[model samples]
Target: MRREITGFSNPTVKLLKSLRDKKHRKREGLFLAEGLRLLTDARACGRLPQMLVMATARDPHPLLDALEADVLASGGEVIVTSADILSKITGKDNPQGVAGVFAEFDTSLDRLDRSSAKIWLVAQALRDPGNLGTMLRTGDAVGAGGLILIDDCADPFSVEAVRASMGAVFTQGLAQAGWDDFLTWLRAGEGQLVAASLREAVPYRGAPYAAPCFVMVGNESRGLPEDYELACDLRVTMPMKGRADSLNAAVAAAVLAYEVLASLEG
Candidate 1:
C-alpha cells in the first residue's frame, strides 16, 4: 500500500521514531535504516524493508524509483512525508530523505556454518555502534562468512551502526551470543579461536592461521579480559610503534582480518 503521511502526530510516525530506542526495537522486533544508498544496498542483498519511507521532497533517482517498485512488489508499504517530518522521525537535523523499517532477522549463533568461510570476526562487549558496524564491513571485505558478536555489544541494528556499515549489515551474516555460549558453539565445530593479545602470543603476520579462523577482538577501552584472551586457541599480537598503545577495536579487527585473509589465500 502507498500512503502519504504529512502530520508529525501520526501513529506510524511515532512507531518509526521509537525504533531509535533499543527497548522499542526489541519489543517490536524491528529496526530502522535510512538513506537511499543503504536501502538500495539492502535491496540488492535480497533484504527489502517491510516499510520504505521517503520524503515528498526527495530528489528523483532511478535507484529510488526501482527500490520503491521492488518494495511494493514484495508486499511492503511505501510512505511519503515531508523532509521536516523525516528529520523529526530520524532525530537528525539533516535526514537522509529516506528511511526504512526492517524486521530483525535471526541472529542466533547456531545458524552460523563454521566451514562456510575461511575467516570470521568476533567482538566482545563492544560499546560503540560505529565500531560494530565497521567490523561488519571488515567481515564483508575479508570474505568472512559473518560476524559473531559476543556478550554485551552495541545493537548492530542501530541507525549509527547501520549507517556506518554502509550496507554490510545486509550483506554479511550476523550472530549474537554470550561468551560461554559462543565458546561452546565454536568448540563444537572445527574452528580456531584466535585472540589479539600479548600473553603467550606470536606476531600477527605469518601466525599459524587456519581455515575458519575466528579473529576475535575485545572491548574498546579495556581490550580482552585476560581469561578470554587465554581461552583462545591462538594469541597473536600486532606491533605498536607510536605512542598509542593499541589500535581501535574495529581497526584492530580489520588489520588482523586482512592478515588472516592474506595468509589463508596466499
Candidate 2:
C-alpha cells in the first residue's frame, strides 16, 4: 500500500527535512536526492532509494510514475504528499515534486591505490556546492580516479551539490581529508601536483599530462593557499584572453580535466 503524507508536519516529511544537515545524514547514513534526473541516475547506478516521495497531484509527471514503479519493484517505500510539504521539506521555493532518501555510498580515500590511479582532482576550500557538484560531474566525465576535498570545503552530498551534479555524486569516489593528510597522500603517490594559478609561467596545456598525476584547484574567491603552493610540482595557468581574469572554479576544473584526458589519449 502507498503511504500518503498530507502535511509538512508529517513525521516522514520532518525526517526528510532533517537530511539537510550533515550530522543527520552522517548519523543516518543516508542522503536526500531531489529532482527526476538525480533520482533516475541513482536508480540507474543501482543505488536504489530507501524512500520515494511524490507530490499528490492529478496527472503527475510521467517520470515520477516511472520512478514510483521502479522504486516499488525494487522493494522500496513510496510516499505521496502535498506540494507544500515537499517545499517545506526541501526548503526550495520550487520543488520538483519528487525527492528520495538514499543510502550514502562509501567515499574512502584509503581505498585508492596510487599505482593504478590516473588523474585526481583536489579541491581546497571550494565553498560553493554548485561548483563542487559541477566539478564532480566533470570529473566523472573525464574518468578521474577520484576527488579529494580538503578542509572547510562544501559538503558534496548536500542537496544543492547533488542536484547540480545530476547524480554524478553517487557514482564518483569522493573523500574528505585535512591539509596535512592531503599533502601526505600527494607525497606518497609522488604524482605531479599541478596547481592552477593565475601567476604561473607554465600554461595548463603545456603541463605534463602523464598518468598518476594530481591537479589541485583552489577556492572560488581566493586562489591556491600560500603553503600549498610550495607543495606543487608545477603551477599551471589557464590562458585568459577575455576581460575576465579567471574562470569559474568548475569551468576551470573541467578545462584542465579534459586537457589531461586529451593528453593521455594522444
Q: Rate the local accuracy (lDDT) of all candidates.
A: 0.92, 0.82
What digit string (tens of lDDT, one per residue) describes model 2 on residues 1-266?
37998876777788899999989988989888888888888777777788998887635667678888888998889988888888888889989878888888766668766665577888999999999998888878888877889889988888889988888887777888898987787676558777777555488885776777777788999867887876788778888999988788888888888888788776
Whole-model alpha-carbon lDDT for candidate 2:
0.82
List candidate 2 segments past 4 Å from native: 58-75, 113-117, 198-200, 242-245
Q: What would the TM-scores of all predictions be?
A: 0.97, 0.87
Stretches > 4 Å off in candidate 1: none
What digit string (tens of lDDT, one per residue) describes model 1 on residues 104-123? 97999988888889999999
Model 1 lDDT at residue 50 = 92
**TM value for model 2:** 0.87
Q: Of the candidates shown, which would achieve the greatest TM-score relative to the real structure?
A: 1
